[model samples]
Target: MPQRILIIEDNKDLAHLLELHLRDLSYDVTLSFEGPKGLAEAESVDYDLIILDLMLPGMDGLEVCRRLRKRPAYTPILMLTSKSSEVDRVQEKPTNGAP
Candidate 1:
């Protein structure tokens, strides 16, 4: 089966672009525009990888990452953000280091 990937980004254009590229690479991609919806999707399915954005509507990527880490299953997460500070903030968190 193709590897499943979840992308949580607020930018519709960017999300679609990413989905297209991932699909080309033979991945089963899922896109979520907001944090809450992304979180729900993450919980419902088993994804091999999760592409998360820093600034989201309901919750930030850091919070989402933190919550995902709390789950029993471990899914690799790749955080995408324009802000360099956000990267530093995520790195500071205790959750099992970034993937």
Candidate 2:
């Protein structure tokens, strides 16, 4: 069985390109354009790996990671970031629920 991969990226072009490459290598890939939907997809399957994006529409990658950790997704997460200030941006977000 091919190893399953979930890519949570808002960039459709990048996500699809990555998916194509991974598929060429005989791996199964699933893509989600938003954090909330990605989290839902991640929880629904026991993917071998999760490729998360730092910036997303509904929620941020760190928040998704936090929620998964709360339930303990049991899947490895490989977070991707393009910005140098990703750390600062992630830290600024509110946790423990929306205000």
Q: Residue 74 in candidate 2 has what lDDT?
A: 70
Model 1 spans with C-alpha error above 4 angstroms:
85-91, 97-99
Q: How do the residues 1-99 of candidate 2 rate in per-residue lDDT, one tens digit apiece?
A: 999999999999999999999999999999999999999999999999999998999999988988887775477888888888757656664443446
Decoy 2 TM-score against native:
0.85
For model 2, the superposed segments whose C-alpha errors exceed 4 Å read 86-99
> What would the per-residue lDDT of candidate 1 be over residues 21-62, giving only the tens digit for each residue?
999999999999999999999999999999999899999988
Provide the overall lDDT of each model, using Cα atoms, as 2-decimal numbers.
0.92, 0.90
Cα deviation of 1, candidate 2, in Å: 0.7
In model 2, the worst 10-residue window by lDDT is 89-98
